[model samples]
Target chain A: MPKVTYRQHDGSEETLEVRAGTSLMLGALTGGVEGIEAECGGSCMCATCHVYVDEAWLDKLPKVQVLEDEMLDDTASERKPNSRLSCQIEMSDALDGIVVELPESQI
Target chain B: MATDEAAGLVVIGGSHAGHQVAIAARAAGFEGPVTVLSDERELPYQRPPLSKAYLMGKQPREALLFRPAAFYEEQGIDLRLGVSATAIDRAAHTVTCDNGTVLSYRKLVIATGTRVRPLTVPGSDLVGVHYIRTLADIDAMLAELDRVKSVVVIGGGFIGLEGAAALKTMGRDVAVVELADRLMTRGVGKTVSTFYADHHRSQGVDVRLSTGVERLEGENGQVTGVILSGGETLPADMVIVGIGVLPNQEIAEEAGVDCANGIIVDENTQTSDPDILAVGDCAQFEGRFYDGSLRLESVQNATDQARTAGATVSGEKKPYDSAPWFWSDQFDLKLQMTGITVGYDTEVIRGDVAAGEFSVFYFKGDTWLGTDTVNQPANHIASRRLLDAGYALSQAEAADEGLALKELVKAARKGG
Candidate 1:
C-alpha cells in the first residue's frame, strides 16, 4: 500500500495507505477522506475530484494530457500551477509516499 | 480598446459557460483586453451530444465546437489554449499560470465546468471502460462500438440510459443497471420515469432497477462483465458509467468561499465573496422552479448562469431568470424537459405514453412545476413558456386530451 497524504487549507494533513493502481480519487474516497468528491467517478467529464499536487510530486505523476487539461480549465476553484483533477492521477508504487494539497473548494 | 489595451476582462475556463461569458462581455461593449484562458487543448466544445448524436455519427465533432476557431480571433480575444490558471491572488487581482505566467485582471470570471463521475468499484481500472462526459470519452466508445458485442451501463440516468440506447441501437446487447428505482428520477417525476423504463424495455434494453454494481469483472486488462450486489453476473465487452457530476470548486474553497453541495450563491449567482461568482453545475444557486427547487445540469443552465454572471461582472445587476430546460435524444425519441418537478403532487398527461409520444406535467396546488415531453417538441416548447410564466392549470384542462397547449397557456394567463 502506498501512503497518500492530503493537506487541507487549515494546514492539517490526512494520510491514507492507498491500494496500488487505485486512482488517487478512490483512494481518498475509500480512506473516508474529506474534501475530494470523486463525482462522475474519474471520467474527466466532471472536475469534482480536483486536487493540487505538491510542486515536488508534479514531475512524478503522468503528464497532464490534452483532455485532462481541457477539463481543468472548467474547474470552479481558482486554477493554479499545482492544480490537478485527482481522478486522473492513479496511485503507483513509484508514488510510495506522496503528498497532495486538497483543493480549498470543490464545487 | 484594442488588444494593446488588454480589455481588462479575465475569463478563466472556455467551454459552454466561459465562451458565453466572453461573448456576452463583448456584446455589452467592454472593449479592453478580453482574455480567455482555456485548459481544453481541443478548442471550445460543448458536451451535450457526447452520448447520442455524436456517438450515432449524426453530428460531427467540429459542429460541437461551441464557436468556430476564427470567432475568437475575429473578436480579438486573447484565447490561450493548453494553459490553465494556477492560482488567483484576489488581493493582487492576478491569475497565476502553470508556465510561470501571471495575468493581471481588473475582474475575473470563473466558469470552470463539471466532470463525469468515474466508476470506483474494483476492476474499474480495466481497459474498455469509459465515461460519456467528454469528446474523448465518446471517441473511444464510438470506436469500440463496432467491436464490442455487449455493454454494461452502471447508471440508468439520462446519460447512461441514452448511451445504452444508442449502443443497443447499433445491435449491441446493453444492460442498464440503475441504483435508483427508475430512470431520470432527478430530471422528471416518477410517473415519467416509469414510462421511459417501459419504453426502453420495449426497445430491447435490459432495464435493471434497484440493482447496484459491486464491481467490474475484468480479464486480460479488459472489461469482461459487472458483478451485481445480489451476486448476479452481467457479461459485457465494455462499460459506460454515467452516475452524475459534482461542481469543480476546489480553488474557490481554498480561497475561503462558501460551498454546500456546490458553491453557494444567491439568486444572482454571487458566492459568499462579492469578488468571486459561481455558475454551471459547480454552483448552487438559491432558485425556485415551479413548485419545487432548482439547480440544473444542462448546457442551458451553464449558458444562462454564465450570461448572468458575465453581465453582473460587467456592472449590470440583472436577476438571473431563465426557465430551466434540458433534452436527451435516443433512437428517434427526443426527451425534452422544462422547469424542475421535484415535489409535485399531481402528474397530468395530455398524450399517449404507450405510443412513445406524450407529455407529462407535474403540478403542485394547481401550478405547473415541470413537464417532460417525449417525442412531442411542441408540448415541450409550450410547457417551457407556461412554466416560466408560472401559468396555472385546472385538473381538467391539464389532462384534457383535446386541449391545445398554446390555447391552454393563453387561458392560464387570463387568470381563468
Candidate 2:
C-alpha cells in the first residue's frame, strides 16, 4: 500500500493508505477526500480531477499524455509545470508518499 | 409518518443520476434514511466505459463502478439492488417494489433512466443480436467476442460507433449501417457527422450511410447476417444496435405526473406534485440552450440535474440552468461538445480536420451556440466555460486560429 497525501486548497491534508493499482482520483474519491469531483469517473474525459503534484515526485510518475496535457491547461487553478489530471496517474507501492495539492475548484 | 415504511429520500434508477441523488443527498447533510432502488443486480457503474475501455479490455469490470460497494453502506445510503419500483402511490408518498416491499418517502426522486429501444425487425430477438445499454448487455456481447469475425453495427450513434471502434481495436472486421445520410445527425451537426463518418472510414470501418436494416438473418436462433434495405445482405457473426433511446417515464406518467415526451419538471426539478422530482433522461426541462423542451440523454445532464434535485431534497433549492456538455471516444479521437447545437446560423471551423485536431464553433448570427472539439481538450473545456457564462464569440473571431478563446473570455469579463 502507498500513502497518498491530498492537500486541500485551504492548506489542510488528508492522507490515505491506498492500495496499488487504484488511480489517484479513485483513491481520493473512495477515501472521501474532498476536492476531486472526478465528474467523468476517472475516464480522463473531464479535467475536474486536476491536481498539482509535488515538484519532487514529478519524475517518479509516468509521463504525461497529450490528452492530459491539453486538459491540464483548462484547470480552475493556474496550470503550473507540475499540474496533472490525477485520474491519469496510477498509484502503486513504488510511488509511495506522493503528495498532490487540490485546486481551488474543480468546475 | 411511519418511520419503517417511510424514508427521508428515495431515488429510483441506479445509474448516474440515481447514484448522484443518493450521494448528493448524503453530502448535503440530509440526516434521514436514504434508499436507492436499482433494478440492476450490480452496483452503480459508469455506462460510458462499457462501450469503450471495458469493451476493449483497457479496463476491467470493477473499474466501471462509480464507487466501491462499501461506500454506499459507509455513507448510510441503503441500496436495494435487483429490485424495481412497481408503482408509485402519490397520496401515501410510498413506492412499491417488485419484492413486495413498500417504502414511503418524504421526497421521491425519479431517476428511472431510459431502457434500450429494442429493434423490432424480424429475427431481432436472435441470440447474436445485442443492444448496448446495461452491463449485462455488454457481458452478453462479450461472450460472442472470440468467435465473432465480422460485426454489423445497426446505428451510427455514439454507442454503435464506439463498439465498432473497440471491436476494430480488438482485431475484428467492423461495419456501421446508419439510416441517416450522416453519422450522429440527431446529436451533432452535419459537419461533425461527416467528419466522424470519414474518420471511421479511414480506420477501415465500412461506414454505410443512408442504409437501413430490413431484417436479421439468423441460423439456429443466432444472428448470422443483416439483410439491407438495398436488397443486399452483409455477413456478420455479431450485431449491435444503438439507434437511440426512449425515456423511461412510464412510472411517473402512470402516476398522473404531467408528461409529454418525458416527465416535465420545473427549473428546480420539481414535479407537479412537488413531493415528486424528476431528473436525467426521463426528465423534460425547459431551457434556452435547445429549441424546445429538452430531454437530454447524456450522463452530464443526468448527473447535473441529479445534483440539483438532490440538493433541493436536502433543503437547498438551486435552479438547474447549467449548460449541457458531453464527450465521446472512438478510434483515438476524443470528441467533446458543449451547449446544444440548435438553430445555428453559421459554423466556423478552427483547425485542420485532416490532421485530426480541430474544432467547429456554432453560432446563431452573433450569438455563440456551441462547439464540437475533436482531440482538442482545451477547446472543449473553454467552450463549456464560455457557454456557461453566456459569452458569445463572433464567427470571424472564433475562426481565426491566432485568437485564444480563454483569453477572449477573460477580456470580456474584465470589460464587463
Candidate 3:
C-alpha cells in the first residue's frame, strides 16, 4: 500500500494508506477526505477532482494527458503549475507518501 | 404521528440521486437517522460506463461503485440493499418496503429514477433480448457475449450507439436500427448526429436510420433476426433495445403526488406534498435554463438536485438552478454537451469537423443557448462556464477558431 496525505485549504491534513493501483481520487473518497468531488467517477471528464501536488512529488506523477490538460482549464479553483486531476494519478510503489492539497471548493 | 426520534430521512431508489441525497444530507449536518433503500443488491454504482467501458471489459465491476461500502457505514447511513419501497403512506409519514419493513421518516426523498422503455414488438420476450438499464442487465448480456456473433441494436441513442460500438470492438458484427431520421435526434443537433452516423458507418457498423424493428425472428425461443418494417430481416444473434426510458414515478403518483410524465417538484425539489421530495429522472420541475417543465436524465441533474433536496431536508433551503451538462464516449469520440440546445435558431461550428474535433455552438437569435463539443473537452467546460455566467458570445467570435473559449470565459469573468 502507498501512503497519501491530503491537505485541506485550512491547514488540516489527513493521511491514508491507499492500496496499490487505486486512483488518488478513489483513495480520498474511500478514506472520507472531503473537497474532492470526482463527479465523473475518475473519467477525466470532470475537473472536480483537481488538486495541487507537492512540488517535490510533482515529477514523480505521470504527465497530464491531453484531455486532462484541457479539463484543468475549467477547474473551479485556480490551476497552478503543479495542478493535476487526482483521478488521473494512480498510487504505486514509486509514488509513495504522495502529498496533495485540496482546493477550497469543488463545484 | 411518528415521534421525532423515530422519524428520520428516508430515501428510496438507491441509485445516483438516492445515494447522493443520503450523503449530501449528512454533509449538510442532518443528524437524524438516514436510511437508503435500494432494489439493487450491489452497492451504489455508476451506470454510465455499463454500456461503454464495462461492456468492452475495460472496466471492472468494483470500479463502477460510487463509494466503497465502508464509506456509507462511516457516514452512519443505514443502506438497505435489495430492498425497495413498495408504497408510501403520506399521512402516516411511513414507507412500506417490499421486504415487509415499515420505516417512518420526517422527510422522504424519491429518486426512483427511470427504466428502459421496453420493446413491445412481437418476440420481444425471447432470449438474447436485452436492455441496458441495470447492472444485472449488463451482466446477463455479458454472460451471452461469447455466444453472440451478430447484434442488432434498436435505437441510435446513447446507449444503443455506445453498446454497438463496444460490441463491434469486441469482434461482433453490429447493426444499429433507428426509427428516427438521425442518431440522437432528441439530444444533439443534426450536424452532430450526422457526424456520428458517418463515423459509425466508417467503423464498419451498419447504421440504419428511418428503419423500424417491426418484430423479432427467433428460433428455439432465442432471437435470431430482427425484421424491419420494410419487410427486410437482418440476421442477429442478439438484440439490444435502447429507445428511451420512462420515469419510475408510479410509487409517488400512487401516493397522490402530482405527476405528469414524472413526479412534479418545485425549485426546492419538494413534491406536491411538502414532506415528500423528488430528484433525478423521476422528478420534473420548471427548467431554469430552458422553457417549460422538463426532467433531465443526467448525472449532473441527479447529483445537483439531490444536493438541493438534502439541503432542504436539513432545514437549509437552496433552490436548484445548476446548468445541465452531459458526456458520451463512443469509439474514441468524446462528446460533451452543456445546457439545452432545444429551440436554437442558429448554430456556429468551431474547429475542423473533418479532423474529428470541433464544437457546435447553438444560439437562439443572438443569445447563446448551448454547445456540443466533440473531442474538445476544454470547449465543453468553457461553454458550461459561459452559460452559467449568462455570457453570450457573439456568433462571429464563437465561430472564430483563433479565439480560445477558455480566454473568452476568463474575459467574461473579469469583465463581469
Model 1, runs deviating above 4 Å: A1-107, B1-7, B290-294, B411-416
Q: On residues B293-359, what C-alpha lDDT tens digit does candidate 1 reach at each position?
A: 3356777778778778777777787667767878777667778788877778888887888887888
lDDT of 2 by residue, B1-416 (tens): 33365467989988999999888888888878999999999989889989998888877787787777778888899998999998899998898898888888999999998978889999898888988999899999898889999999999998899999999889889999999899988667877898999988888999999999999998999889999999899999999999999899999988999988889999889998898999999999898787689898888898889889888898898779888988889988889888988677688898888898999999877788899999887787778777777776778888889988878767766776
Pick the winner on lDDT between candidates 2 and 3: 3
Report chain A TM-scores, every model: 0.95, 0.96, 0.98
Candidates 1 and 3 compared by TM-score, better number = 3
Better of 1 and 2 by DockQ: 2
Q: Please, what is the whole-model Cα lDDT of each candidate in the order they appear?
A: 0.77, 0.88, 0.91
Which DockQ value does candidate 3 get? 0.56
Index of the highest-TM-score prediction: 3
TM-score of 2: 0.94
Candidate 3 lDDT over residue span B170-206, tens digit each = 9999999999899998789888999999999999999
Question: In candidate 3 chain B, what residue range of length 10 has the lowest lDDT sum?
Answer: B1-10
What lDDT would candidate 2 get against the real structure? 0.88
A72-92: candidate 3 lDDT, tens digit per residue: 987889999999999999999
